[model samples]
Target: MERKVLEVINLKKHYKGNKAVDGISFHLNAGEIVGLTGPNGAGKTTTIKCILGLLRKTKGRILVDGMDSTKQESKYKLAYIPETPDIYPMLTVWEHLKFIALAYYIDNWQEYGSEILKRFDLWDKKDSLGRDLSKGMRQKLSICCALLHKPDVFLVDEPLVGLDPKAIRELKDAFKALRAEGKSLLISTHMLDTAEGLCDRIVVLKKGTLIMEGTIEDLRHKVNAGEDTSLEDLFLEVTEDEKE
Candidate 1:
C-alpha cells in the first residue's frame, strides 16, 4: 500500500457565517500527484490554507505525516507555494537560494543549487534581484526555493499562472523528477490542461464540498465519459452534479 502523506477527515473551516471548507475530506499518498480543482468560490484555496495551517479548521482532522497539524508543526517535512509568488523582492536569486538552504539546514547547497537553477533555465539570472525579474522568472525562483529543501510533500496553488511555454515544460519535468524521488504533491489549480498532464489523481470541489475523488481513469468512469474525454469535460460533469 502507498504510504499516506496527508489526510483530512470531515474538514471544516468557518469564516464567520461562511463554511468555507464544508466538511471536505481526502487523503494523499506518497509519490502521488493529486489535483484539487473547482470553479470560483469552490473552496480550493481555503482547503489548501487549512492544510498549511494558515487557517484553523472549525472542526474535523487534518493529518500531515500522521501528525495533527494543530498539535505539532511538521512544516519541515513539506513545502508550500501559495497562489501568488511570495519571495523577497529585494533579495537576489542566489541570495534567496542561500537563504532557503540555511532555513532547511542543508549544508551542501552549492551543487544542488546549480543543478536546480540550470534545470529551470534560471542560471543566467542567478544574481538578478527578484523585483527586477519578469513574472515568469520570479515564479521560477519561488519554485526553486520550494524544491531546494527537497521535502516529501509539496502543496502548490496556481503554479502555471505566469510561466511561459518552455518554463511550463521545464516545470512539468521538474515535478516528474520530484515524484521520481518519492515525493508527493497536492496541487490546486483551475488550469485543467496542466492538471490533466501532471496529476495522477484528482479531487473535485464545489461550494466548499467535495464532489469527486479518484484516479483520472476512475474519474472518467464516474463521469460516464469516454477515455478520450478531457479533464475539462469531466470537471464540468462533477460540478454540474453539485449544482443539481
Candidate 2:
C-alpha cells in the first residue's frame, strides 16, 4: 500500500464567527500530485496555511508522513511555496540557497544548488541580491530554495505565477521528476488547464466547503459534461450557483 504523505481530516478554521475552512478532508499519497483548486475565496490558501502550521486550526487533524503537522519534526519532512515569494532582500541568490542548506544540515549542497539554479535559469544571477531580482527571478529562487533539501512532500501554491514559459515548463518537469522519485505534491492554482494536465486528481473547494474531488474524467462525469469537455468547463459547472 502506498503511504499517505499528507492527510487533512475534518479540517476547520474559524475566525471571529467567520469560517474560512469548514471541515474539508483530503489526502495525498506517495508519488502522486494532487491539485487543490477552486475559485478565489475557496479556502485553498487557508487550508494550505493550516496544513503547514502557519495558522492554528480551530478544529481538525493534519498529518505529514503520519506525524502531527504542528510538530517541528513534521515540518522538516515537507516544503511549501506560497503565492508570493518571500525572500530576504539583503541575501544574494546563492546566499539564499546556502541558508537553506545550512539550516537543513545538508552536506555538499554546492553541486545540488548549482544544478537547481541552472535548471531554473538563475545560475547567471547567483550573485544578484534578492531585491535586485525581478518577480520571476525571485519566484525561481524561492522554488530552488524550497527544493534544496528535497523533502518527502511539496505544498506549492501558484507555482507558475511569475514564471516565464520556459521556467514554467522546467518547473512542471521538476514536479514530475519529484513524483518519479516517490515524492508527493499538492498544488493549488487558478490555472485550470495546467492543473488539468499535470495533476492525477483534483480537489475543488467553494466558500470553505469541498464540493468535488476526483480525476478529470471523474469530474466530467459528475458534472454530466461531454467526453470532450475541458476542466475549465467542468469547474464552471460545478461551482456555479446560478445553475438552472
Candidate 3:
C-alpha cells in the first residue's frame, strides 16, 4: 500500500460570506505528484495556504505525514513554494539557503544547497542580494530554499511561471528526482501543458469547489474526449459553462 504523505479532508475557508475553499478533499501519496489546477479565484492559493497552516480553515482537517497539520512537527515535514517569490530584500542568495537550513534545523545542508543553486543557474548570484535579482532569479532562489529542507511533502504554486527554459527543465527534472526519493508533491499551476506531462493525477477546482480529480485518462473518460484530447481542451470543456 502507498503511504499517504499529505491529506486534506473536507477543507474549507470562508471570509464572511465569501467561501474561498469549500469542502475540497484530496490526498497525495509518497512518491506521487498531484497537480491542482483551476481558473483564477478557484481557491488554489487559499487551499494551499490552508494546508500550510498559514491561514486558519473555517472547517475541515489537514494531515501532513499522518500528523495533524496544526502540530509543530507537521510543519517540518512539508515545504511550500508560493506563487510569488517572497524573499528578504537585504539577504544574499546564499544567505536565504542558510536561513532555511537554520529554520528547519537541517545539518549538512551546504552541499545540497550549493548543488541546487548550480542546477537552477543561481550559483553565480549566490552573493547577490534578493532585491538585486530578477523575477526569475528570485523564483529560483525560493525553490532552492524550499529544497534545502528536504521535506517529505512539497506544496508548489506556479512553479514554472517566471522560469527560463533551462531553469524550467531543471525544475521538472528535480521534481522527478524528488519523487524517486519518495517525496510527495502537490503542485498548483495554471500551465495545463506542464500538468499534463508532469503530474500523476490532476485535480480541477471551480469556484472554490473540486469539480474533478483523476488521471489524464480518467479525465478524458469523464469528459468523453478522444485519446488525443489535450488537458487544455479538457479543462476548457469543463469550465466553459462557468462563463455563461
Candidate 4:
C-alpha cells in the first residue's frame, strides 16, 4: 500500500489563553487533495503553520511520510506557498528562481525555471525585479519557485486571492497535474467554489475545533444535507449548528 504522505494526530496549538487549533487530526495520501477550510479566525492558518513547523505545536504529533515532522525536521519533500509572496526587493525574478532551485539542489535550473514561468504566464517578466512585478505575477513567481522542487506535498494558504481568472484556471490545472504525479496537497482556502471543485476531501473547523471532515458526499450526508448540496451551503449549515 502507498504510505500516507501526511498524518496529524490530536494536533493542538494554543496562544496565551485561547486555543488556535484544538485536537484536530487528518491524513492525506499520495494523490489526494484535501481542502482545509473555515471562516476567518477558524484555525485554518494555525493548523497550516503547525504542519509547516513555523509555529510550535502545543501538543500532538504530525508525521510526514511516517517521519516525525518535529523531531526529524525535514525541510524538503514539502513545498509551501504562503498567503503573501516572500520576495527580496533587490532580486530579479530570474534570480529568485536560481536561489530556490539551488536550495532544492536541482541542476539544470534554467530549463526547469523556463517551464514554470511559461506555465504561469510569467516568462515575459523573468528579468523584472521582484518589487516591480504585479501582485498576481508575484504570486505566480512564488508558485514557480515551489514547483521547481517538485516536492511530495504542497501546502498553500488562500492562493486564489490575487489571481485573475486566467491565472486561477492555470493554478487549478497545475494542482491537478501535480496530483497526477502522486503528490499530495493540503490547501487552506476560503474560496468555497474552488474548494468544492478541486478537493477530493474537505475538512472544516470552527474556533479551533474540527466540525466536519470527509469527502464532499460524505460531508453532505453527515449533515443530512441533500445529495446535490453545495459546499457553501453545507458550510453554513454545519457552522450554524455549532452556534445553537
Tell me the tens digit of each residue's lDDT in model 1 across 1-244: 7799899899998888898889998998999899998878889988888888888789999888898877646777778987678878899999999999887788989899998899888999998888998777777788789888777788998888777887788777877877888889898988888888999998988889888888889989987899899989998877767668
Error of 4 at 8 (Å): 1.0
How large is the C-alpha RMSD of every model relative to the true structure? Answer: 1.9, 2.1, 2.1, 1.8
Against the reference, the lDDT scores of all candidates come to: 0.85, 0.89, 0.89, 0.87
Q: TM-score, each model? A: 0.91, 0.90, 0.90, 0.92
lDDT string for model 3 (14-129, tens) is 99999999999999999999999988889998999999989999999999988999999898888888878889999999999999888778899889988989877899999999
Question: What ranges in model 4 sit over 4 Å off?
Answer: 71-73, 105-108
Please give the range of 10 consecutive residues that has the lowest summed lDDT in model 2. 235-244
Question: Model 4: how large is the Cα RMSD against the reference?
Answer: 1.8
- Comparing 1 with 4 on TM-score, the higher-scoring candidate is 4
User: What lDDT tens digits, residue by residue, belong to model 4 across residues 69-114?
Assistant: 8764455777898888898879998999999877767888799789
Clash pairs (backbone) in predicted model 4: none
Q: What does candidate 2 score in Cα RMSD to the true structure?
A: 2.1
Ranked by TM-score, top first: 4, 1, 2, 3
